[model samples]
Target: MAPSKTFFSNFRLSNIVNLLLRSLQLVDGLVVIGLYGIDLNRARKEDKYSDGKWVYAVTVGSIAAATAVVYAFVSVFMHYRSLTFLFAWDWVLMVLWAALSGIFGTMYLNEKVEMEAGIHRMKVAVGFDLAGLVLWFVTAVMGSLWFFRERWGGRISRPGKA
Candidate 1:
């Protein structure tokens, strides 16, 4: 039998989606980092009871961002076959990250609205959080498509047993 000329075999959609996922992951990570930094600064300056929430956001965001950056770098720079074992887990993580980011963004936006004044920095942080949520969702979707494409023998068929 000869080699198939499917999308995955020729590095077409899979490669494109992989690159897009990596780029979005990088952007999401950076945005989360920025949000964490801003939240940290705000916590330090305000010292409000609710600052603990920001601290929690920062802690979670930092870890999530770091994970995203490392994953993005590996997915982009390393050989494709070398990371095949991670495809399933990567998509799962992206979904989880998307959901968590959406929750965090909503929380921050709510907090921003509750504040009376001097919320410029918090607003910026909330904006970044929102951006991160969008990026995470897109990345998750792309990753899922790539996963299904590979699993379905690269024909873009309905997701099920081949």
Candidate 2:
């Protein structure tokens, strides 16, 4: 609720979540400006410059990169603390998250396949698309929670526990 007292505090897990929550405010920005530009360029205008599409892609990329960087910055700042739980699930969750995201992207692309052979009937790739999207959403949420779990000392490690 209150502003952080220092840079390190601003980089805390709760603060990271607050930053992500604030990022929701950019949804309209992405829709209006990033997804479809407001320039006077005619609607009939060819995307020769590809400005709208580029904006869309770049905006998504930037948001993802910024989120990762902010989390990394906070992790670096908290290095002195015994933030060991971060190690327990971070890499595993990160790998799974990446896999799910890749599946989502690939399925999205594959969902548009076209065919012509009469013998080769068509089938909807809807299942893959749905599964991918579901996995992506779950992975994103879990990954974020894992990233911020250390904020409350959610886990404790014994000296000999693995």
**TM, every model:** 0.57, 0.28
| Most accurate candidate by lDDT | 1
lDDT (Cα, tens digit) per residue for candidate 1, span 1-162: 344544235454455566666566566556656656665676668984545556655655665566566665665555444455555555555455556556555654656455555365556665666565565556556556555556775565556746
User: For residue 18, what is the lDDT in candidate 1?
Assistant: 61
- Tell me the deviation in Å of residue 117 in model 2: 24
CA RMSD of each candidate after superposition: 6.8, 12.4
Put down candidate 2 lDDT per residue, 67-97, tens digits, no spaces: 4444445445564124434333334433443
Candidate 1: Cα lDDT at 49: 50
Name model 2 segments beyond 4 Å from true.
Answer: 1-47, 79-108, 111-140, 143-162
- Clashes counted in candidate 2 amount to 0
